[model samples]
Target: MSPLGSRVLGRPDAVQVWRNLANARVNYSVDEVRRPSWNIDVHRTALPAERPGPPEPGGSWEQACRLVRDYEFSPPEIVRALYDPAAPLLGRDMLLEARFHGMHFYCGVRVTGVVDEVRDGTDRVWGWAYETLEGHLERGRATYEVVKRQETGEVLFVVSCHSQGAPTLDRITSLGWRLFGRRTQLRFYHRCAARLRLFVEAELRGREPLPGRSPAVGRLVWAPSDTRTHHRDALAIHRVAPG
Candidate 1:
């Protein structure tokens, strides 16, 4: 069983360790920035192409790959597609598959599980359950918005909720240091696109999100820029519309 499973199965020490890790806080510095194009190149070489099989029945590997590509380039498009009751089964299936695979949309982190509570007129809120490979479940939530362009009918945004977790924050920052050999902090910038790609692909493929899967991967080609950073910051400032 996984460490988290072990703890849930009655390992007190494991549970305590998990809690301790979750509560710890650490600080990270932004060492550098890269654009999404650059980050993508880095991720392409770093992340292996070995993909897992898709879910049964309606799910297929090709469909999963398409979902990943679509969501990666245009989150709002995927979200809009899902809102369609008559959309292909692949859309709905991919969402559920992503949850099981430990992938978080937009951000490049793994989620343990997700509960969607979207209603008419309300922004969709997904209660994301997080767990470490060792079986530690940390608590977190994410909200999503589907933005549309007024003039072109083009989808512009799929704004996501801000992520917060004492344990997760610490571990991810620690990972940045360990992997980059610098005290790098995590940000919602384009620099993370490479890392994000791997996780996103994994989610589509119905596999658990594994960090450091491509430890040697340099960086994403399309790393975030000041403009993109500001965009995310702006979105953070606005409240998600209620469902």
Candidate 2:
């Protein structure tokens, strides 16, 4: 059920895509990526937060955290998330249907790690990271985190990633990636970071979350801080009707 003139993946197609992507191995060697090399590109950005100190239960911080977990922070202009509704975010597999210049590209990524901890009684942090799977256009890992300083209650949405080119058998595709991939990747990060900030700020003011190209399914819970696992249920976001 793609849109007219666009290759938008539907639920059934997404389900099948998930099956294939889940089995693909990481395109790059994790061990090799750890080595210092100029070939890798690194990026980081800090998103704005409302106040300083631990966020109130069911408040903006909590709400924003849930949104991040569900991968809803990504602007639909860049990527479409295709995930299994029954799965938990921590280890979820996703098919990212990336769109640019009226063309579509598909890639796979999976949650490789999750962090939930307090640092020296001063900060509470929660985050997860994902890595590119086989056949992906790029090879790398990205980490996203929401951090709240206990003393000041300052919350920040932070994004960081390291990426490099995936070996391509074709010369033309490889050249194209070399010329434009980094620019596109940076743009995606910037937009998504900005979008998340907007959503968090709106939730803090009890205003409606801004609408755009992104689509989410099922009911959403705005706060994850109130109950430890509440947001996990909200992460069950599949667009198809239940059987």
Candidate 3:
């Protein structure tokens, strides 16, 4: 057991500690995700879009689909909105940055799942979800999706996550989570969803989307490991079973 485990009891592994920061329910099915009994807070926001006269030959939702596929919303300004973006995708792992209630956090998450052509009716949805490797202030997976309804020719962006405050050694971080973490988290989701919609709309209109601007305000801490053992599991796409 690590020294940190002595304080928490039984949980001696830092890697396990990081993983536990996310809500365990994240690994459950999409239907389970929509269930009313999540252990942590659940959030959903419909991204607004103009019909724009059917999709552009190939598909109306193609533009939005590309945005989500390329991770337009995962940038520094979108992590928590008031925080920073990820370090970059290297192997199956990524370094994530964020600020909350005046504390800056530098963490890591492993790409756990990627959705490709996860079909819902005539709509095709694709996205990815990442789990905290270590250093994250919360534990849980956040999945981003771009869905196109073939019948309605509507493209929608959706973001969902199940998370709770992680056990932290920092006094301020712990206090901050206890006080305003949940509220701050919901705010991040709203802003990120809005930003994603703006980007998609800009692309659909043939206009370059402006980058979001948010000042970094908080502490800085890097993950304990510079790199993790590569995992083939990262490339394996976990497709949702059609209902």
**Residues 127-191, model 3: lDDT tens digits:** 77776543456666777777666566566777767765555435645676668767767777776
lDDT of 1 at 102: 19
How high is the lDDT of residue 58 in model 2? 74
Question: Weakest 10 consecutive residues, lDDT, candidate 1?
Answer: 94-103
Candidate 1 local lDDT, 14-60, one digit each (tens): 12332233332212111322333112111111222222321223222
Give one digit per residue, the lDDT tens place, for model 2 in 146-192: 88776775677777787776664246446666677677888888887
Stretches of candidate 1 exceeding 4 Å from the true structure: 5-138, 144-146, 150-154, 168-243
TM-score of each: 0.24, 0.75, 0.60
Better of 1 and 3 by lDDT: 3
After superposition, the stretches of candidate 2 with alpha carbons farther than 4 Å from their true spots are 1-12, 34-53, 210-243
Each candidate: RMSD to true structure?
18.1, 9.2, 11.9
Q: Evaluated with lDDT, which candidate comes out highest?
A: 2
CA error at residue 121 for candidate 3, angstroms: 3.8
Query: Which of the two, 1 or 2, has more TM-score?
Result: 2
- Candidate 3 stretches with Cα past 4 Å from truth are 1-60, 74-91, 211-243
Give me candidate 2's TM-score against the actual structure.
0.75
Clashes per candidate, residues 3 or more apart or on different chains: 28, 7, 10
Best by TM-score: 2
lDDT of each: 0.26, 0.63, 0.49
